[model samples]
Each structure stands twice: as C-alpha cells, then as structure tokens.
Target: MTPTQATAARRSKISPERAQELYAAVLDELREHGYEALTMEGVAARACCGKSTLYRQWRTKPQLVAAALRAHRRGTLAAVDTGTLAGDLREAARIAAGTSGRDTRLTQALGLAVLSDEELQAALREALVEPELAAFGAMVQRAADRGEIAAGHPALEFLPAQLMGVLRIRPVLEGRYADAAYMERFVDASVLPALGLAPAP
Candidate 1:
C-alpha cells in the first residue's frame, strides 16, 4: 500500500455510530461558521474527538466535508425506482426538496470558497453532484428502455440542470426553499412537458 493508504489503514477505526456523530458535527460546524472560518480544532471539539483523530481519519478539511456530504446523501437518489420515468423524476424531486433548505444553506455557506479551492470543488462534486447525476442517468436510461421517452430525447441532458436549478434558485427568487409540492409541480409542469411525457397521476 502507498504510505498514505498505509497510514489510513493503520489509524484506529471509528464505529458507524461514532462516524455519523462526527459527520453531523462537521456539517453543523460548517453550516454555522462557513467554510473559511471552520477549523479542525472546532470540529474535534464539537465532535468530542481528538484533533489527531480527525487528521488521522480525513487528513484534510475538504476530505472530511466530502465524506460527511457523501454519508448524508448515501442511498437517497439511488433508491428511487417507481417503474416509470415520471414517477421516478417526481420521487427524485421529492427527495431533493426534502433537503433543499439545509443543502441550500450549506451551499451558501461554502460559497466562494468552493470556487477558489480546487480540492474542495472536486470533493464537493464527487460527494454531492456526481452520485445524483449517476442516479438520474440510471433512471433516465431505465425510462428509455421502457419506451417512456425516446432514447435520444434532447431534454435528457438538461434534466439534472433543471431540477438543480430550481432547487438552488427558488430561495433567491421567492425567499423560500423549494418544497416537495413545488418540486413535484416542477416535474409535472416543466420536466415532464420537456421530455414529452405526461405528469404522474
């Protein structure tokens, strides 16, 4: 194993419950203090763990944040399968809406730090963006296979952007986070129409 991997493997293992607590603490610290002001010392204190443990486990702040995000979103979108594209999309929208407020706050918290820090940017994309995209792509592919929409439909490419855009912009435009009802309506009114599919009944 590489030295980094070797070191990581040698570090004491954290139980799943303990890990969740630590991740929660990390996100709580991030939301309250923002990325620039967040520190490993603060997280360790909040999580009630040694600073050395945090460093040993995650090695960097970006990595810890990424891990926390991944853990938070684990199995969320991937579990959506309703046997229809419209149903799946609506389900995904519902899931996105559930966390919209907290996630929006988290994104706002990170703000320009994400732009300036390459590691943070890449980590965030890997943790938050890529998995959801993959899940959405899988749902679309299944829909195509079921002949719900044309495989070459132009709207497929914009689906993720559309859903994510509404989630991110609703707060800015309406001063409110997108809720499940709003997201479902968006899927019915905007997304389904664009894909030449009818709204879910």
Candidate 2:
C-alpha cells in the first residue's frame, strides 16, 4: 500500500482496552521470544486478532513493538513525593527495585535490537527513559525549592543515571537482581551522599 494508505490505516481507531490487550500480547511475545524471533503473525495469533488487523494498525513489527512499549509505559516515578529529595530518591529506588528483575529481563531481550532499530530506540526512550528523567527532574526541582539540596549540585545531573544504572547493572555485576533493600541502601549510601545529603530518618 501507499504511504498515505498506510497512515490512514494506522489512524483507524481501536478501543483503548483492545489496544492495551494487544500491547500486553506484544510484550509477552517479546519476553518469550526475543525481538529477533518475534513476528507480527505470532502477535496476531496471541492477541486473537486477524493478521491484517496488525498490519493495518501498525504497518510493521518495529511500529507495532514501539506502540506496545509506549502503551505499556507506567509513570511510576512521576508519582513519588516524599517531601524531601532523599526520601523521594529512596522511594524511587524502592519502586525501581520492585520491578528490576522483570524490567531488566525485558531490557536484555531488546538490547541489541533496540540499538540497531532507530524506531525501537526512540520508543524505548519515549516510553521508559524520558518519563523517568522528567520525574526525577521534578523531584530534584522540588528539593531545590525546599532548600534540601543546592540548585547547582553536580550530583543532581546524574541522579537518574545513578538510580537506573544501579538497577540495570546489579544483575550483571552480582548475578542477582537489585532488591528493594539494596536499592534503598544504594540511595542512602551513594545517591544521597553525592548530593551532600543524608538518608532521612
């Protein structure tokens, strides 16, 4: 089909609930079979929808997977407000630790494929990375406003990387997922100290 026709096909509305179902099916397929092995036909079969429907909606595997990742986004960090930067960072750490295993596995599954596929890389950033970065920025801004941390503290720039890096790296370095306790300790030991703050009592 022509580009215009493809764009029109993509504009066809699917219910929010149905879209979520399809997205879940796509994630499940990705988890069970890494990106290289995932197929539009498999997603169609798993979602119990017609293959043509998948094609009409997303046009290709990269588009479909991107949509799925976007739809699956949960703004977990955006909700954190513990009244202090240290408390907020600890809460964020706890939350990240809670899902570290599942998320790490998903990241690993999509690792090389996402690096090569611009569409997937952009989707991952939009769906996962950017949201968290925004949330952390908000948290840091709030802390600065409250005078809990200096506005120009260098560590502020690295907060997201510090938290996300630990979550992604623990499994690689220790062969164990970063748990809530470990994450909380990390915030106390590494993150807070870097900002010249101490863990909240």
Candidate 3:
C-alpha cells in the first residue's frame, strides 16, 4: 500500500489519546495480573473498549505489551543537564535509580514473561530497552563531544553499567534503598574518580 493508504489505515485504528488510554490500561492489567494472565480481552474490558479495538491496534499479546511500554516511556533521565560532568553523572545515576524504582514491579512481571518466551523478549527489548539505551547513548555522546571525556575512554561505555549496577545491587548488597543521596554519593566517590573528573572546587 502507498504511504497515504498506510497513514489512513493507522488512523482508522485508533486516535492517539485513545491508544494511550488503552496502553495505560494494558500496563495496569499487566502489573496487577502477571503477563501469563494478561489477555487482550481483559485489557479491552478494563479499557472499556472492544476486543476488535485491541486487535486493530495490536494483533498480538507481545505487540500490545510492547505498545504499552512505548506509550509510557518516560523513565527518568528526561532532563539531566547539570553543567559539570560530576553533576550530570549524579543526576544520571539518580535517574537510573528512579526509573527502576518507578517501574520495578511492572518490569519484574515483564522479566518473568520474557524468561519463558523468546518473542516477548524481543518485543520487550525493541519496545523498552532500545529506546532507553538510545537516550543514554545520546547523553554520553554529548558528554564526549563537550570534551568531558575522550571518545575512546573506557569510562564512556561503563557509565550505564555503573548506574544499573548500583540500582541492581543496593537492596541486595546493603539491604538499603538506592535513594538520591546514595546515587549522589556514588557519583562523588566512585563515578567521578573513575572518569578523571574531580569534584567541584
């Protein structure tokens, strides 16, 4: 079909606001009921729409879940410019912690579902992981361009890993939360020194 025809077909599916409403309802359903129990019928009923409506938007369960993830992709790291590299790194760490904290339960469900399904894993990565990585890559690239770090610096690729590491390990390691204070300290003590960027004078 032509581009215009494709556009028309998509428009006929659902309005943007309605699609967002459906996506939000689907995510809530996934959160309350594990992905194993999540069904398009249930999502349709919850969203007060019809099964055909759900099908029109997303033909498969993974596709529907993927759309839900994409629709609600505002996981922290939205606004993270603090002038100094140390400041930006601190905010970046907090953003990582905040994003996980905000969506941990739901993502846990997604994780469970992906463990048993390959298609779901691919869908999840494309829908959620890729976008997040893309956003972070852009920031890291900008930092490099700003001469904060050399392009080939080992620390560049390690930044996201550090952010994720702290979030993933805090509760398990210290039996404590990775709060903003902890995130800030991680930047000050560990992240900054690693990047060769000393703390503010």
Candidate 4:
C-alpha cells in the first residue's frame, strides 16, 4: 500500500465518547491556561490524542473552543416552570450557580479575547448567552401569562443582562464565587423588586 493510504488508514474516526473527552480536555486547558494560551497541542495532550484528531474534528482553535463550550452547555432553564417570574428567576439562578468554578473561570478567561475575535465572540454568545436568553424569555412569557409581571415591563428586556452581569462580576467584587444561595438572594433582592414582584415564598 502507498504511504498516503497507510496514513489515511491510521486516522481513526472519532467516536461520540472520544469527542466528548476531547471537548472536556479543551475546557480543562482553558481553565488552566486561559483562552489566549490554549492550543490544539495542549488539548490534544490533555485528551491523550493526536493534534490531528482535534484538527480533524474542528478546523480551527476558535471552532474547537466553541464546540467544546457548546458540548458542555447546560439546559438548566429549558424546562423551568416555576409558575411565576420571580420563582423562575430564583430557580434559574440556583441552577446557574451549580456550574463548577472552572466554567466560570473559563468564561472570564475568554472575556477580552471575545471582544477582538469575531468568531470567538459568536461562539461565546451561541454557547453561553443565547441559550440562557432564550430560556429566560420563555420564563418571562410564562410570567406574563400568569399576571405576575406585565408583558411590556422594561425590566423584562434586561433580566438576562442583570443576571449575567451579577454572575460575571461577583467574583471580582466579592473575591468569592457566586453560589446558589447568592444567586437566589440576588433574584429576590434585585430581580423581583425591579419587576414589581414580591420575593418568592
């Protein structure tokens, strides 16, 4: 057989489990080294696979990182039906706080880079921001239907921003991670009051 044929034969097709392993390795590397320092080689090494494996799965670093984030994305708010916006917000906050500190660190690590890199920006938004916004929007609609909040409340438009802002900044301001209790408190103290709703029972 020709050398080209031999090389092609040696390239194993990546399986779902193997791909998940690589995605996790990429997140681990990002947590350890930050996005700016992450490399295909580092992820490959961490995943115990060849660089060609990653390159074959994702053509570029941005794509690889994005894919990794998407792979690990949570569906915390997908089925959130607390019957009230306040309750939903509190529940959402609780779920978000369950995320590991590593995920939070990886997010902060990618902040500046997302500003300058369009692809990275889109990936970050798609993997992180968009899903949360979509689910929150759904919760708001449900609240409107239940008469807990007005459909046209101005604060309705900013709920995602408010929650995301607190989650992102708490570590900087408090020198501590935003845990479930903190999130629930923020929802009760800030989120509900802003929307003219009472705190959850």
Listed in order, each prediction's TM-score against the native is 0.91, 0.86, 0.78, 0.86
Number of clashing residue pairs in every model?
Answer: 0, 0, 0, 0
Candidate 4 accuracy as lDDT? 0.80
Model 1 misplaced stretches (Cα beyond 4 Å) = 1-12
State the displacement of the C-alpha of residue 137, model 4, in Å, after optimal TM-score superposition: 0.9
TM-score of 2: 0.86
Please list the Cα RMSD from the true structure of every candidate, rounded to 1 decimal place: 2.5, 3.9, 3.6, 6.4
Tens-digit lDDT string for candidate 4 (1-201): 953244234434677788789889998888878889999999988988888877765667887887788678565788788787778888888878777355678788786898899988876676567877889889988888888778999988888888778877888888888888899998888888889989989
Residue 187 lDDT in candidate 1 = 94
TM-score of 4: 0.86
Task: Give the Cα lDDT of each candidate.
Answer: 0.88, 0.84, 0.74, 0.80
- What does the lDDT read for residue 144 in candidate 1? 86
- The candidate scoring highest on lDDT is 1
The lDDT-based order of candidates, best leading, equals 1, 2, 4, 3
Candidate 1: clashing pairs of residues: none
Residue pairs with backbone overlap in model 3: none
Instruction: Please identify model 2 stretches exceeding 4 Å from their true place.
Output: 1-12, 70-75
Cα shift from native, residue 26, model 4 (Å): 0.6
Compared with the true structure, what per-residue lDDT tens digits does model 1 show for residues 1-201? Answer: 864365347444878788899989999999999999999999999998899998888888998888887777634899999999999999999999988887888889887998999999977787688988999999989998998888889989999999999999999999999999999999999999998888888
